[model samples]
Target: MDPIQRITTPTLDVLDALLTVDGPAWGLLVIKATGRQAGTVYPILERLERQGWITSSWDDETDRPGPRRRLYEFTPDGVDAARDLVAARPSAATPAPSAATPARPARSARPVTS
Candidate 1:
């Protein structure tokens, strides 16, 4: 397994989302993308930053109050990492065919003794 490909579950999801978009995404966008709350999304984004898979900066243009919204973007490795993760997503489970459909082989008849 590639070392970077082993990124934690939440981090992988965040990176994949960032990779899909044309530019960086703010926290709310990430939240919407992953259906994850800020509590979960922020921590994962921090981890991705630490891993060097993604980078973030404050968005001064956003109208949000308090601090500028932190926007995230994927590094080259982040894109590669996302690709690996996507390739690794477990295939959807498929039900096995019914056993009843297979026919049993017929037994050969034995010759009768004289």
Candidate 2:
């Protein structure tokens, strides 16, 4: 895909989520991975497809009972581009600490009064 003009945090999140998967990923899987809403994830996926960064196809399996899911995967060039882009952004590589992780206390510049 031509270099993404608007690379927002949400877009990075989606790319990161896709990269984590070994194979093609579905819309709901992306949403859950990125913790983003359908409104956010679907548009990004569409944009990526339009840009030629990714391609999508409907799941062909008929044995399962649910609706056919659309699976998305990066094109060969897209994977290279995405990895370079994501690596350049250090913030995206480092995940935010969760509630279970202890927060570091801020060090005071001035001494505390007894």
Candidate 3:
């Protein structure tokens, strides 16, 4: 697989989401896991597939009563690459700030008239 040219945060998030799953992940699952919209997730998936980082196939289960979902999983080499990439980003491992942690107040745009 060619090296990913630009590893954006959304891409990292998608990779991280994929890592958490045991088997091939569908697009919506990745979307929900990353809390990213379809617009952002689908393109990343397509790019990853094009770069050979991942492979996709249409779900063939006949019993399922819905549209065939495209399943995506990393190639043997892709998994290692993805893990290394995700691990290198410190922010990826950082947990979301909890409610107990006070949020920083947003600065007002208007200048103070004092």
Candidate 4:
């Protein structure tokens, strides 16, 4: 499987969600797990498929009430690459405000100009 070419927050989020599951996942499940909109999630899935990092297949359960879901799973090699990429990414759990990009000052900090 080919490694993902361009990595972004959305892409990484999708990958992270996939890694948590034990098997293939569907688009809606991924959207929920990543907290990404459908617009962002589908394109990311397509690109990852094109890059050969993942594969998709339609679920074949005939007993289901609605249409079959398209499930996505990382290719064997993709699992390893995804782990490495995530490990290298900066942690987003709780970003500290750096001096270069300071957080907004409190309302009381503003000068009491006439």
Which numbered prediction scores highest in TM-score against the true structure? 3
Clashing pairs in 1: none
Show model 1 residue runs off by greater than 4 Å. 1-9, 62-67, 92-114
Error of 3 at 95 (Å): 16
Clashes of each: 0, 0, 0, 0
Per-residue CA lDDT of model 4 for 1-114, tens digit only, reads 766667888999999999998899999999999999999999999998888889999999899888899999999888888888877777654477688986776776677798
- lDDT values, one for every candidate: 0.74, 0.93, 0.95, 0.88
Highest lDDT: give the candidate number: 3
Error of 3 at 82 (Å): 0.2
The residue-level lDDT of candidate 2 at 88 comes to 77
Q: Which stretches of candidate 2 lie over 4 Å from their true place?
A: 91-114
Better of 2 and 3 by lDDT: 3
Off by over 4 Å in 4: 91-108, 111-114
Model 1 agreement with the true structure over 4-102: per-residue lDDT tens digits:
544556765676678778888988888898887789889887777787878888898856567678888877877786777766655422346679889
Model 2 pairs whose backbones collide: none
* Candidate 2 structure quality by residue, lDDT tens digits, 1-114: 688999888999999999999999999999999999999999999999999999999999999889999999999999988888888778765788899989999987997799
Model 4 RMSD to the real structure? 4.0
In model 2, how large is the Cα lDDT of residue 2?
A: 80
Residue 28, candidate 3: Cα error in Å is 0.4
What's the distance in Å from true for residue 45, model 2? 0.3
